[model samples]
Every structure is written in C-alpha cells, then in structure tokens.
Target: MFSSGDLEQAKTNFPEASSRDLKGKLLLPGFIDPHSHFGMMISAIGQANVAPPPAGTVTNFSDIIVALENYRDAFGIKLSEWIFAWGYDETQLAEGKHITKIELDKAFPNNPVYLQHVSGHMGVANSVALAQGGIDENTRDPIGGRIICFDDGKTPTGLVQEISMYYFAGKAIEEFQGKKAELFPKAQEHYLSFGVTRAQDGMTDLLSMAFFRSLAAEEKLDFDLVTLHGYASLKNDDLEFKTYKNGLKVQGIKLIGDGSRQGKTAYFTQPYLTSVFGCEKDCVGFPHGPQDELNRLIGLAYEKGIQIFVHGNGDAAIDMVIRAHEEESKRLGQPLDADRRPVVVHSQFVREDQLNKYRDYGMLPSFFTNHAFFWGDVHRENLEDERAFFLEPHS
Candidate 1:
C-alpha cells in the first residue's frame, strides 16, 4: 500500500487515471480464447470421475477391453447406459493399431462403448453403441468424413473420422439427456476461476450458442464467448450449417484437414520414421478437403462473410489451406478486412514458405503449441527432420 503523500503525488502526475486499492490480484485483458470446445473440456474433466486402467502397457485391443472393464469397475460405470472414455492412444497398442469393434463387443457386450481418440478427431464405437445411434453398414459417411468400413465387407469397422464422429456423437450426446442450461454455468464457473475472460469454442453450433446466450441472460456466463462453428462441409445443399450459422455468435466454420500425428494419419512429405520403407513421398494424411471442395467452400464462406477456420495439423494440409486462400484472394483481387482474419487453426506443421503465404494472403493463425509438449517425441520419430523443425507455434 502507498502512503497518502505518495498517492497524492502519483495522482497529481496522472490526474485523469484511476487507481485501485483492491487487495486481490488483478489480471489484464487479452483476446481471450478467440475459440475451443468447452464440451470436450467438460467431457474430459467429467471423465476424471471414471475408472482407471491396468498398470502396464496396453498391449492390444484385448488389453484395452480389460483395462476399460477394470476402470469401469473402479468408477462404477452403470450398465444402464454407454461407457464413454477419451485419451486413448492407438500408437501404444501392441500392433500400434486402434481397438476394433469386435474386441470391444467381446468385453462389454451388454454395454455400448464410445472411446475417443486422443486427438479428438476420430473415435471407435462398439456395435451396440453404433446400433444405439443408428449408424449402420448402410449409413453413408457425411460430406466431410468417411466411416471406415472393413474392406470387402459391408460391416462398419467402428472407426468414425472427422465429420461423421460429430454427427453421430452429437446424437449420442442428446441421448445422454444432459441439458446445456445445466452444464454451461458449471463450465463458465470453471473458466472464470482460471482467469479466462474470452474463449473460442470449436464446433460450437446454434444450439450450444443458445445455451451460452441463456447463461448470459441469466447472468451465469462470466466470460465473453466466441466460437468457430465446425461444419462437415460447406456444400450448398447443407441447410443445417446455414441455419446454425445465422443463429450463433459464431466467427466461422472449421474443417479438419487430417488426423493428428498421434493417429499417424497426418499427411507428410516423407514416410514415417518408424516405417521400414524410407519411401512413399507425398505421404500426406487423409485429405478431408479433397481437390475443388476446399476452393468451393472458401468462395462460399467469403461470399457469405463467414470466416474459415481450418484444422491443418500436417504441413501438406497447411500448404493446401494457404493455396486455397491465396487462390481465393487472387480471384477477389482485394485485401481482406482486419477483423476477417480467416484463420488456420492447429498450424502444427506449417513451413516457413507456408507462413509467408499466410502473410501474403493477410491470414491469421491459431497454433496448438501444446502438441509440442504432448507429442514431440512421436512427431520427431515419424516426420522428416527438416519438417519436424517447423511444427507447433509456427515460430
């Protein structure tokens, strides 16, 4: 605390400024989280109440099944509903492959299961869970994602990628019957305690937006919330996006370009470091924005004044995103507005050239630098030495 004389002298020097005699620590302002998936946070935090795994390497799908059963036993997972879990890494499994539907069925035949990949981009669901959600062999993949079907068979393999995961998983959330009104306030309280004044919620749609608005209306929302409404694809025929777009405090749409390094699905310029073959150039991850679709979506987004928030974890995908943006900008032949900072979210492997391209197009980026801390070793082992140097934070 300052003395009265000191206070007087300070005030005299800055007469127009106000002073705080407050006791608690005060924080400064920033962009806040300009986006996020609060739902994922809630789910992740909520899972702490669940079971624990066995004390060894998860050797295979069988081990995962046993571990989940053990975890469920410890956590009292009710058989009346589904068994939902996250933070499972496939690379560590015995074959370094994901758990299949058959393995899950054998263990928890009576219960439905939904295990999300650590990346939050893909998930494996048991047959019971798929049947509960009405995702079947005949169910075609949505515009943005592919439902991985076992080759030469009509049976669904239970691996749902990109958009399809959201589509069916959302329906599953509905089945849980948890209301947003009851959840958002709890989530907001958690955010405020952490000094978060703003956040950008990924995959936030109009329904979730209404929930946020309701919280604000009721004085429950403590932080300023913004979101990138993630879409399956921006095809003109999709009415859901248009409707949801009109209804939210959304900044734009998100397209997940490929899977994360943890999933070994990220597109790379070279082969995996662990792969026996020092071969397979252009080893890009599965392309979510194939060919002209990305271009078309950018044009549509620009025309509608909605920003594009693409999820590009691989350098190849980043380059594609930059190329698409550059093409769109050249075609428009004008500079974009400062606020309309079309962003590349998760620029985990952006090269210097790509960064230049981003600057050239007046684009903004949101890097998930956290990945470096989380999966740096795997990235180093799998990607070429030159490209691995450029991932995360994009510095």
Candidate 2:
C-alpha cells in the first residue's frame, strides 16, 4: 500500500529493515500466561481424566467410578498400588453430590484411592488412603484446612479441603519421582502449539525447583519458564533465588490466602445462599492464617526483595492481602514499588471498594475470567443473582 517514493524514503531511513511479502496471511502476537501451574498441568495429563464436559466429559457419579476402575484395571495396578485421579466436581455430577469415602471403599477396597476436586483446593480419599495418611477423626485440622466429617463430627467423610489436600496430594505426587523430565517437554510442546512462548509455573517447591535446575543443566527446554516459589518451600534460610540454564528463573514467592470459590472454600465477607457440601449454613469460608501471620509472610518476602503473588478468590481474602501490603508498606516507611507489581491471583469476587484499594496500594489483579464462562451458572446458584453477577467485574 506504500507509494514508491515513500518506500524509498523508509528504506533510506532504516537500512536494516527486512521485509516479508504476505499477500494473504494472519499474524498475531504470542500469548503470555501470567498465572498458571505448568508443572501441575503436566502431572494431570498423566493422571486419569474424570472431569466434566470439555475437560473429560465424565457427566455423572457413575461415570467417575467407572473411569477410575477402568484406569486401574487397564494399568494392571496391584492392590497395594495407589490410585490418584483429578477433575472431579460435585456440582457437575448427575447426582448433584460428592463421591463419599464409602463409595470409594466399595470400589477399591484394597487400593488407596485419592480423587482431587476440580477446584484444586480439595480432594476425596478412600478409607485406606485416609488411614495411610494417618488422618483419623482424632487428628486436628491444619491451620488453613478442614477435614469434612460426617454428621457425627468425629468420623471423617474422606473429604479434605484447602491446605489439608496439600499433604495428602503431596504424598501421592512423591511416588511419581523423575517424571518431570518426561512430562515437562511434552507440556512445552503443547504450549507452543497454542502460540504461548512464555509460560509461568505459578507455584513451585524446592524439589520441583531442583528438577527444573537439572533440566536447565541438561538443556532440555526451549521455552522460557518463570516460577514463583511457594512460601512453604522457602521456610529454610539457606534457599535463595537463582537463575538456572535454559531461561528458567525464580521470579518471586507465592502465597495462598484462601481456597477456590467453586469448591466453597474461599473466604468471603458473607455466607453463600446454599450451604457447601458437608458444611452448615452461615459458612463464609476461611483464610489460610490470621492477619498477623499474613503480614509476617508479606514482610519477609518484601525484605527478601521478592515480589509476592497472593491467591485471594474472595473479597474477605483480598481484604487480608490489602491490609498486609499496607502494613508492610508502612513498616518499611515507603510505598510498594510499582515496577515490582505485586499481584492478586484469581481475584474472582472482588468488590468496588477493593478496586480503589488495589489502585491505592499499587497492586495488580490477575483475574481468572474463564470462571465466568465455565462456572458462572454454578456461581449464580450458590451466590444468587444479586451477588453472582458482580463476580470478576471489570468496572
């Protein structure tokens, strides 16, 4: 579309410019996923698919049980071997209920079965799996987690929520040692196909970081990987940030302030319209810790010069993060560095006031807008029209 004189002038002005002729073609920029769990997604690919439509298409409770049993039988799994499955949702099932420990026990009496909730904040374990984890009725709940018990309040229903799933699911993952070398490359290829040149492993522990470092040493990766080291993994004083080979960098630290809203575990200022599975009315959910504890963690990360990404899906949780940032800024006698860009990940239920606070604190919100499409109807059911429509509001 340029005239001959204009083209000559452009070439004279920039001799280094190289031109590509494309009469008819489509061109776009590469996608950058700011917040995602690349390692976890790779692991899930190797596990059985039991999620509902689009992800797995397992529609009902019966379908889930059949899928797990089939996977176990096809793999010739021994009775002593553990069976782990992900992508199970109670709301999506035909029965409109969660699979209980009793049902899993009946299906796999010998094997220790662990079925993770689609929300990634909870999971269900059979009796054998519960026993293996030493999680009996007598065991107290962890700081930010809940062991959903039966009506008796003494008998665990095999459902674990929030931080409780971390321990049980973590032990299961330990069994799959050295899998990163095999799975990560495949995940990278899949990302490339989608035009994503840069990816983020939103949460990483020491073990995973060491594996990534080893991969870097071997020069196995082709794309860039940025990891946010989990707070739990940084408890040791010796561990510090370092850039490894193959463009892998430890960028910052991550903290989970609350759980998933779909799973009804995210802390909120008000209760849900309907009670959560295995929970009573007026259940406003819970936070991972008190304000003081959150303040301490944020302060520590700030002192270390690490950017913090706090996961706060509900308004109450976001409030905690805002308060912590404010306290830390005041304590340090300075405002947050805008260039560092502390983020509130998966901020699904933020209110109008919170947006102003975020601007005042120089904080960024990275919303999981996909929830608006995949789980919007379910959210409406739980929150009612008045509150649900306001979820992830852009204004």
CA lDDT scores, all candidates in order:
0.66, 0.83
Candidate 2 whole-model C-alpha lDDT, 0 to 1: 0.83
How much is 204 displaced in model 1, in angstroms? 1.4
RMSD of each: 5.7, 3.2
Per-model TM-score versus the true fold:
0.77, 0.92
- Report how far off residue 264 is in candidate 1 (Å): 2.3
Output candidate 1 Cα RMSD: 5.7
lDDT of 1 by residue, 118-138 (tens): 777778888998887678979
Candidate 2 wrong stretches, greater than 4 Å: 1-23, 233-245, 336-338
Tens digits of lDDT, candidate 2, 1-395: 33345777988877887887767987667787878888777777667788998888799877988999888888788987888888888888888877889999998899998988888899999999999988998987889999988898889899999888887778756855567667777888898898887788988866777887787777876777888877875566645564544778877789989998888989999998877866677888999889999999988887766788999988999999988888888897766544457899978888889888777767888857788778899899888787799888853
